[model samples]
Target: MTFQYIAQRFERSGSGSDSFKALFKSAFDLMKEDTANASLYFLIAVAAKSYVRTYEDQAVTEEVAERAKTILCGYNTRVLEALAAEPAARYAIGSGIAYDYEWQVADF
Candidate 1:
């Protein structure tokens, strides 16, 4: 699934519900299981960070948000820097290419 599609699924699954952690966990697990999709999964986790921020008034706690941010920081600095350099690249899900069209991760 594309990042957009997966993000939409996260929204449809209920943003502030208890399922957020589960969904985020699932995405993280997918990252661990599929190395080729690491970038995509990382983006999903980044989206989760944004999600947590967007819905901070809901069930998502500060601890969970902090954990998400911490995990994102665990990624290779060079890779993150490379991705940061090409914010407008096209990322195809399952293609093993780390690119996302106009996806701004600056806040990340």
Candidate 2:
């Protein structure tokens, strides 16, 4: 999926960028290995790393960063598998209603 799609879904869920960067990195790793958009993912990875470097609250060690990346990559792989297995429902359900009751509550 494109970064925009992933970003939209992530934002819609009201998640923070700190958490998102990790998942995005994991997704990029997967994409680079299995998809044709490796270059795009690489660019995204660079941007993500830059964002972290600019905004990180405290100093992060290389070891910790690499370990976090590895863990999140595993998580991303499992999520992708589950998504592929159970695709999202495509239909939209809507409801419409017309009020027929009196406005008696206005007498309060």
Using lDDT as the measure, the top candidate is 1
lDDT (C-alpha) at residue 72 in model 1 = 37
Instruction: Output the TM-score of candidate 2.
Output: 0.37
How much lDDT does each candidate structure score?
0.46, 0.41
Candidate 1 Cα misplacement greater than 4 A, ranges = 1-12, 58-108
Candidate 2 lDDT score at position 49: 54
Q: After superposition, how far is residue 70 of candidate 2 from its true place, in Å?
A: 27
lDDT of 1: 0.46
Q: How large is the C-alpha RMSD of every model relative to the true structure?
A: 10.2, 16.0
Weakest 10 consecutive residues of candidate 1 by summed lDDT: 92-101
- Per-model clash counts, in order, read 1, 0
Q: Against the true structure, what is each candidate's TM-score? A: 0.41, 0.37
